[model samples]
Target: MTDFSGLQQLTSLIRNIEAQMEGAKLMILTHEHREEIARHMVEGLVGPSREHKVRIETSSGEYMNQLAILEIGGNKYTFSKDHQGMFISEINYYTCRITPNSHGILVYHQDYPGVIHDVSRVLAENKINISSMNVSREQKGKSALLVSLTDEEIPQSLLSRLQQLPQVQQVLSLQ
Candidate 1:
């Protein structure tokens, strides 16, 4: 009878420990899910983000990687990651530059010799550093140059000088 009583007491203690461990595991799983949710939220809102919802066509499972865009403007930016949510860790080592920032100032006209160099010279003469630069021309005479200047405040004189060039038709500061 004494041995049976000791076994019953030990069994009761073991049951209690098992119950507590189960509760702890539940708590841990809940915490992990919450952490994953929060990580995705921050990734969605930061930087110049454009979301493209897509899925992998594999037998494993369905998953989506949100394309996080870091636009340097004018088709150049660091590709952050393809994550299921906005989880901003530098874990994504992939990079890409697309759909560049043409918002600062766009100069358009017919393509001519010395136009690009002249534009640079004008900016250099005015002491404004070009933060970024892009040039595109199609078949025919159409041409466009996008420039991101260190100075947001572009002087009217510089704008006028660009317009005065024989081959140039339009000089517009986008943003």
Candidate 2:
């Protein structure tokens, strides 16, 4: 992603902090080698001022991967960078894939055959077009997450249907 796109993506992740979060604490979790880039990301997200409601910190994490975890809105989200670019690596500790795509659906479900088809069918039935998709699984038949980029917002009824799926554990729509 371009710098602008990266900033836009970071803004989406931190929008809640700027809009409704009060007395927020943002933890930048990464390896020592990534402190510089992590700090730059923190500044981009919360700005340079110390008076904001967000408390920023850059702490050493366990690994050397180009990943950063943010604690905001009572949740922890992990974003990682790779050759493909920056995307959400996990949410609330669940392994998943999501980019700063700005609009998409995040589905946490059991790793099972046809889950992807089922999700696509639901969206297709509702006339929602999938622009892209990213799926990550911890193991076979175990916890998994699918992030689907769409052209439009997911309706509440469609979202409810997705939540009702037998393999689905959670459904989150991001815009």
Please identify model 1 stretches exceeding 4 Å from their true place: 1-103
Question: lDDT by residue for model 2 over 1-175, one digit each (tens)?
Answer: 1342463366465563334555555555564435455555555565656345556666667544445666666767776766777766766676655666456678889999999999999999889999888788888999888888888878878888999987999887774
Q: Please name the candidate that would achieve the greatest lDDT relative to the true structure.
A: 2
User: Which pairs in model 2 have colliding backbones?
Assistant: none
TM-score of each: 0.40, 0.67
How big is the RMSD of model 1?
22.2
Per-model CA lDDT versus the true structure? 0.39, 0.69
Q: Please give the lDDT score for candidate 2.
A: 0.69
lDDT of 1 by residue, 73-166 (tens): 1221122123221221211122211121222345666777777788878888887777666565654455544344344556777888878877
